[model samples]
Target chain A: SQTIHQWPATLVQPVGSPLSLECTVEGTSNPNLYWYRQAAGRGLQLLFYSVGIGQISSEVPQNLSASRPQDRQFILSSKKLLLSDSGFYLCATSTGTGGGQTEAFFGQGTRLTVV
Target chain B: AQSVTQLDSQVPVFEEAPVELRCNYSSSVSVYLFWYVQYPNQGLQLLLKYLSGSTLVESINGFEAEFNKSQTSFHLRKPSVHISDTAEYFCAVSDDGGFKTIFGAGTRLFVKA
Candidate 1:
């Protein structure tokens, strides 16, 4: 059974501060990782996705960036957070090629509040 | 490119009543459809998915969705929804050969007692 873990379940930061959110998956290797943000009562917006280490794809241009430093470790970072960056950030992982289904498993999510 | 549309933003239904949430998608290529449920303050959970098998896919919680290829729709239906079923439901689509998953605006289901 694979599980995804995200740190700083809830975060409060002042405007223009740096942001770093970490996600790690246990029991799986070489999994595809993704970062998504959801506004209150709104749909999820894909920020970035990584196929492998040092490979990241940006979906929408925003103040955030994502990195896959390790096979099962993904990090979402921001040099200076904006007020619009306040939302629920989710980390998801899917097995590599030859895996059964393409369904993604998500972590508990980090709720960031920028004040 | 693929895009998903969830028709309803909010659906209010009495407990134990039947409910249906509509979803439509536009993709030039064959795509995999999925329905995910998000409880309050929780991450999204996979409810069901339609890949290449039967058109109808069911979850363990009595929710079923049928994929209509011609109509480009995958509508979620539940015979009797419980109060616990109150949550936000999202419809997502991904191309068969692509890794990007496009999600809809989502529909909030409120099952009142």
Candidate 2:
């Protein structure tokens, strides 16, 4: 069975500090990876998605960026955190093929608080 | 481009009562629809999906959804909901062409005992 791991499970960052969140999937190769953020009482917002190594698509223009450094390793980074960046960040993976039909599996999200 | 709309932001029901959460999508091409449930402070879990056949799909937890092509809707329903079923439910849609999935704002299901 495939599983996704994300860390740190909870993060507290001061304003203007750097941010790095890592996601790694075991038991799967070449999977589609995605980064999403959910504000309190709001819908999940797509931040970025990667199809392959070194390939990433940004959905919203913001203070965050994503990278696929390896086939199953994805990272979300920010040079400087903003107060608006406080939210729950989720990393998810889906089977790569047959577009949109395969269900996405999610990791335990990181609750990020930018103070 | 594809989009999803979950009609209710919150649905409150008593435990063991029937419940229905409505969802609708808009897309030009063929699409796949899904319902995901998120427990408090946990990641989203796939409840059910409607891809091609039968127009109806069911989850192991007694939740089911029917895909209506003409109505462009996929509504999730459960005959009797439990207090454990109290969670946030999301409706999402993706095109058959491998595009990214777009999720609705989500509906919070509050099942009171």
TM for every model, in the order presented, reads 0.96, 0.97
Q: Give the alpha carbon lDDT tens digit for every residue of B1-113 in model 1.
A: 78898999999999999999999999998788899999988898899998888999999999999999999999999999999999999999878677777789999999999
Candidate 2 lDDT over A1-115, as tens digits, reads 7799999999999999999999999988888899999886678988999889999999989999998989999999999999999999999998747566478899999999999
Interface RMSD of 2: 1.5
Error of 1 at A47 (Å): 0.3
Off by over 4 Å in 1: A96-101
Q: DockQ for model 1? A: 0.49
**Which candidate's TM-score is highest?**
2
Give the Å error, residue A24, model 2: 0.2
List per-prediction Cα lDDT, in the order shown: 0.90, 0.92
Model 1 Cα shift for residue A26 (angstroms)? 1.0
Model 2 backbone overlap count: 1
Candidate RMSDs in order: 1.5, 1.0
Off by over 4 Å in 2: none
